[model samples]
Target chain A: AQTVTQSQPEMSVQEAETVTLSCTYDTSENNYYLFWYKQPPSRQMILVIRQEAYKQQNATENRFSVNFQKAAKSFSLKISDSQLGDTAMYFCAFMTHTGANSKLTFGKGITLSVRP
Target chain B: EPEVTQTPSHQVTQMGQEVILRCVPISNHLYFYWYRQILGQKVEFLVSFYNNEISEKSEIFDDQFSVERPDGSNFTLKIRSTKLEDSAMYFCASRGTSGGETQYFGPGTRLLVL
Candidate 1:
């Protein structure tokens, strides 16, 4: 079974500053995918970014990016120019590439607070 | 962009009652999934469906839990006998056919068992 771990339970960042959420996983598969999801106070889980294990280049959205170290089984999310709206519970997820029936294994999550 | 939508934003049900959660995944997606997050816990996968059948399910998805894609646009999760432990946020998600595609999630339905 694959497992994702988010060591940080809670994180805070001043508005306009940057913050990084740590994530690690245990998997024997070499090809897989990693994702970062944000759940705001409204309880809506939204996709923030994704990274394919086969690709060494990290994935970046407008304000979100990931540092994916495939060999180390580490995938971290970085939020740049953080805003109050960025405050949310962030989850790290892992999906294997082998099967069409792959399911996401998620981390416990990290609560982020972008303080003003 | 298309998004997944879930019905009955919140539901309150008796401990032994049956509850059905509905979801409408993105129109073009082929694979669907149901996940649950107990209060203050990580989201856990319940089941994954494709081609109108269950493709994968976790141990938590026991006989009490079932999933169906009754139609093209709707995917549903039914719990035969609800328990207090079932009171949590349930989210529906879908992904395109492309391998390892990113999944889009619904806002989630909060279930309360009293």
Candidate 2:
């Protein structure tokens, strides 16, 4: 079985500042996918970013990026130039590379608050 | 942009009662999944359905739980007997392609078993 761990239960960053949320996973499978999801007050789960294990290049989507260290089993999300809108609960999830029966294993999640 | 949708944004039911949660996955998606998040807890996988049958399920998805794709567009999760612990937010997701594609999630249906 695979497990995702978000060590930080809560995080805070000032507007225009940067914040990094840490995530680690335990998996024996060599190829897999990693994802970051955001849930705001609306209770909607939104996809923030994604990273593939085979690719060494980290994934970047505008203000959001991830530092994926495959060897260390670490995939951390970085929110640059954070804004108040970035406040939400962030989850780190893992899925096997196989397309069939792809079920996400999610972490406990970290609550991020951006202060003005 | 295409997206997954779930009905009954919130539901309140008594214990031992049956409840059916509905979902309409992306039109062309081949794989569908159901997950749950207990208040302040992690999102846990319940089951995954593909090709009209369940492809995988977790320990939490016991005999009391079942999934069905009754039609081309609708996928449903049925709980035979609701329990107090069953109160949680249920999310539906679908993948459009094979390989490691991203799974688009629905807004989620919050089920409260009394």
Candidate 3:
């Protein structure tokens, strides 16, 4: 069984600043996929970015990027030029590369507040 | 941009009552999933369906819970007898055929069992 852990309960960042949310996972599989999802006040789960374990270049989606360390079993999300809209609960998820039948294992999530 | 849709945004039902939550996944999606989150908790996977059958389900998905795709577009989750602990936000998700394709989620149905 795979488990995701987000050690932080909450994070606060100033508008136009940067914030990084850390996460670690326990998995025996050599290759898998990781993702970051943002849930705003509207309670909608929106995909932020994804990283495949085989890719060491990391993943970047505009202002959102990730630091994926396969050896250390850690994946961290970095939000640059954070806006007030970034305030929400962010979840880190894990899924194996086991074709199409994979299910996401999610962390407890961390509430991020962007102070204006 | 196609997206998943769930009916009855919020529902309040009494204990021991039967409740069915509905979802309409993306038209081109072949895989569907159901997940739930208790307030202040992590999102928990319940079940995943493909080719008209459940491919994977978590331990949290018990005999009391069942899933179906009665028609071509509609996917539903039925709880035979709801308990107070069943209260949570249920999310419906669907994924495309590509292995790397991300799962698109619905706005979620907030179920409050009293």
Candidate 4:
């Protein structure tokens, strides 16, 4: 079984500032995928970014990016130029690369509040 | 861009009643999944379906829980008998075979079992 841990339960960032949410995982598999999903008050789980274990380069998406340390089993999400719209519950998830089952094991999530 | 969609964004059901959450995956997606999140809990996988059958399931997906991709376009998760503990937000996700491993998600259905 895979376990994802987001040590911080809540974080606050001033608008236009940056925030990094930390996440760590325990897995024996070498090949897999890491993801950050954002769930706003609307309850929709939106994919923010993803990182493939094989890719040495970090994954970035506009204002969202990931610092994926494969050896440390750490995948943290960084939101640059944070906006009030970015305030949401963020989840760190893991998926196996071997199969089509592709179920995401998610962390408890961190509530991010972007102060206006 | 095409997106996965789920119906009855919220549901309120009595304990012991059966509830079926519906999802319409992206038209060309090949894999579907069901997940649950209770209040402030983490999202947990329930089951994964492909080729019209279940490909994988978690321990939480016991006998009371079942999934079906009936009629080719709709994927549904049926809870035979609901318990108070079953109240949670259920999310439906779909993955395309061509994509680089990102699963698209629906808005989710909040099931309140009272």
Candidate 5:
């Protein structure tokens, strides 16, 4: 079974500052996908970013990027120039490259607060 | 971009009653999934549907729970004899055929069993 771990339960970042949420996973499969999801107070799960295990190159989307260390089994999300809207619960997820049958295994999630 | 959608933002039901949560996946997506998050817990996968059948399910998906894609756009999760533990936020997600396509999720439905 695959397990995702988010070591930080809560983190606060000053406005326009940078914050990184830590994540690690336990898996034996060499081929898989990792993801970061954000859930605001509205409770919508929004895809923040994704990284394919086969691709060593990190993935970035605007202010959100990931540092994926496949060999170390670590995938951390970095939010740069954070804004107030960045306050939310961030989840780290893992899924094998099982085509369409794969299901996501998620972490307990970290609550991020972007302070004004 | 098209988005997944779920109905009834909130529902309250008595214990032992049956509850059905509905979702409308992306029009062209072929794979669908259901997940739940209890208060302060991780989101857990319940089941996945592909080609009108269950492709994968977690151990938490017991006999009391079932899923059906009765029509082209609607995917539903039914819980029989709802217990207090069943109260949680239920989210529906869908994915395109591509191997690495990210699963798009809908705004979850909050179910409360009292």
Candidate 6:
């Protein structure tokens, strides 16, 4: 089974600053996908970014990017120019490349606070 | 951009009662999924559906839980007997492709079992 872990329970960042949330996973599969999801106070889970395990270039979307070190089994999310709206619970997820049953394995999550 | 939408933003039901959460995934998406998050916990995968059948399910998805895509666009999750432990926000999601594609999620339906 694949497992994702987010060691940081809570993180705080001043507006306009940058914050990085740490995440790691344990899996035997060589090919997979990694994702970052944000759940705001509204309780809506939204996709932030994604990275294909085979792609070493990393994925960036506006202020969000990931540092995916496949060999180390680490995938971290970095939020640049953080704003108050960025405050939310960030989760790391993993999806195997095996079959159509691609269920996501998510980390416990890290609560981020972007104070303005 | 098309997105998944879930109905009944919030539901309050008595224990042992049956509850159904509905979702309308992206029009062209072929795969549907259900996920839940208890208060201050991780988002747990419940079940995934494709071709009108269950493709995958997690341990949390017991016999009491079932999913159905009754029509062309609506995907539903039914909890036969709601329990206090079932009090959580349920989210419906869908992906356009099959090989590790990104799944778009709905705003979620909060289920309160009392």
List the candidates' TM-scores in order: 0.97, 0.97, 0.97, 0.97, 0.98, 0.97
- Residue lDDT tens for model 4, B1-114: 999999889999999999999999999888899999999898999998888889999999999999888887999999999999999999999998875488889999999999
Candidate 6 C-alpha lDDT tens digits along A2-61:
999999999999999999999999999988999999989998888999999889899999
Candidate number with the higher DockQ (2 or 5): 2
TM-score, candidate 2, is 0.97
- How big is the RMSD of model 1? 1.2
Off-target runs (Cα >4 Å) in candidate 1 are none
Off by over 4 Å in 5: none
In order, what are the TM-scores of chain A for the candidates? 0.96, 0.98, 0.97, 0.97, 0.97, 0.97
Error of 1 at B67 (Å): 1.0
Task: Specify the poorest-scoring 10-residue window by lDDT in model 6 chain B.
Answer: B94-103
- For B15-88, candidate 2 gives per-residue lDDT tens digits of 99999999999898999999999998999999998888899999999999999988789999999999999999
Tell me the tens digit of each residue's lDDT in model 5 across A40-104. Answer: 99989999999999998999999999999988999999999999999999999999955657899
> What is the fnat score of candidate 6?
0.78
Q: List the residue pairs that clash in candidate 6.
A: none
lDDT at A80 for candidate 1? 98
RMSD of each: 1.2, 1.0, 1.0, 1.0, 0.9, 1.2
Interface RMSD, candidate 1? 1.5
Q: Give one digit per residue, the lDDT tens place, for model 3 in A51-116.
A: 989888999999999999999999999999999999999999999844446899999999999999
Backbone clashes for every candidate come to: 0, 0, 0, 0, 0, 0
* Predicted structure 4, TM vs. truth: 0.97
**Candidate number that wins on DockQ, 2 or 4:** 4
Residue A71 error, candidate 5, Å: 0.9
Per-residue lDDT tens digits for candidate 2, residues A1-116, read 89999999999999999999999999999989999999998878999999999999999999999999999999999999999999999999999955668889999999999999
DockQ of each: 0.73, 0.80, 0.72, 0.80, 0.79, 0.74
Model 1, B9-112: lDDT tens per residue? Answer: 99999999999999999898888999999999999999999888999999999999999988779999999999999999999999887553888899999999
Listed per prediction, chain B TM-scores read 0.97, 0.97, 0.97, 0.98, 0.96, 0.97
Q: Write the per-residue lDDT of candidate 6 for residues B1-114, one digit (tens) a residue.
A: 898999999999999999999999999988889999998889999999999999989899999999998899899999999999999999999988645389899999999999
Error of 2 at A108 (Å): 0.4
Clashing pairs in 4: none
